[model samples]
Target: MDLMIANQKSLRNLTVLIIGAGPAGLSAAIQLERYGIDYIIIEKNKAGGLLLNAEKVVNYPGFPHGVKGTELAKLFTSQVQIRKIIKDEVIKTGYREKYFETRTKLSNYKSEYLIIASGTNPRNTNVIINKSAEKKVYYDVINLSHHKGKTFAISGSGDAAFDYALTLSKYNKVIIYNRADKIKCLKKLYDRALQDNNIKYVKNISVLKAFASGNGLALTLSNNNRIVVSYFVIAAGREPALDFINSDKELENLIKSNRLCIIGDVVNGIYRQVSIAAGQGIKAAMEIYYQLNKENN
Candidate 1:
């Protein structure tokens, strides 16, 4: 919640502008700081990205007992001690005349290098949703865990779906509906969910559409069945979120020239991991630092 606007003059002094504050972006900023680079990290939301949705980070190194998503996010951001951070969204970005130009709602920036760590956005389902019930639909259950004694319907077969179910089942009823016969999550998550009576996994079914019920949504399933729930959460999957930038030959050439780099979850596909993102961030910062040093010499 460190949202703030930057002056045009402050932005122009940046050598590199990073568009995200997730683990990858934070790592890049930390590395840049170590190298005495003049850079800025911009983010529209709090810095965790999808990592904030994780229930328990068991695979990340240095945490033998596993850590909560929010807890780890705190640690990541705390370590950065970021030099310059713009708490605004990047509205447009592109490369021209040897400089990457980025515009946010409040300010514009020109830098020698640009790093897009903007991560992924939730993949939308093809199911049509009625306007009346649209307000009750969500893609992630991050801050919705405190609600007690209400029914939640989750759609998807991936780990996110099951994870959402587990998180909500702690205080409410959770039913995970999957269109596919086989679930895409790990067996351990499935087994744990099955053991909890509050969580139910319904296979071979999909939420085709949803309409307004009394105070909730009456979901119409693909098999012509109906069920009502307080809210509908979709954990289908995610894809790269780069809609803010225009796609053109010039942008492609910038990438090809290494002046503009897209790293972290934006390009990692299914290999998304905190460690991988952090390593890539550090490497990109190093590369940018060396390139700038070579230019000065």
Candidate 2:
């Protein structure tokens, strides 16, 4: 049936459909469960989103020694065991008068209220890299064991780039190549990395091309230089998964009305951190509860 027709019938029931099963989405699910609200969590990939690809997460609470991203995600998934967790990607979303419908690869689900916690996708590099070189490059180091004891190069000038370099430097000789003259990472991190012997800085360098060489790789620097490395990581930035949000005018209005909440990295101008995303999820859930209760009376 059509989305508008589905939405008209869906409003009588207060089912909340949450997109993405990252920290934010899981946190919201926990809140909804505590309030005895009916809800479902949908994830396109695994439960963790980018966290799944992180080697270790040191900043999150309750873990003094820090925890692996995948492990932390497992814990989050366990917390929302009562709610229906669908392992499918949301392709589109649309709304009618009082409800919204999200279309996924497997099936279509309707909800009276929707919360978008779907995170962002890693940005692609503009430089021309061969298919093999592209396969060797990664955005996260969760699978770093494959490139152990090898020389690695990371491209970008941000906190994520710095963090990736620092973490990988423990096992591999890491070199950071940035297009700009100045590094844009946190002062402390930049200072620390500068002092590391295993890490090298290549400023005012732009990668023009990359090609696979034997078991490793070769990169052509913009200055007509070549650097060979075993692994390359691109921490450029991220693009929001907001195609569904833009398709539905009524859903957008609901978001503006504060009836529907968009949290996590998919929302514009929000920092991409596990703790921050979880906090936003809690806030969205609380607001949703308050609004639902207020509407009933």
User: Which is the leading candidate under lDDT?
Assistant: 1
Error of 1 at 5 (Å): 18
Query: Per-candidate TM vs. native?
Result: 0.91, 0.84
List of clashing residue pairs for candidate 1 = none
**Could you give candidate 1's per-residue lDDT for residues 125-194 as a string of tens digits?**
7988899988899898876877999999999988899888888888899999999899888898889899
The alpha-carbon deviation from the true structure for residue 35 of candidate 1, after best TM-score superposition, in angstroms, is 1.7
In candidate 2, residue 152 scores what lDDT?
Answer: 86
Poorest lDDT segment (10 consecutive residues) of candidate 2: 1-10
The TM-score, computed over Cα atoms with residue i paired to residue i, of candidate 1 is 0.91
lDDT of each: 0.85, 0.80
- Candidate 2 per-residue lDDT, tens place, 123-216, comes to 8788788998878888777677455688988898887777777777877899998999887777977887888888898899988888999888
- Give the runs in model 1 whose Cα sits over 4 Å from its true position: 1-11, 247-253
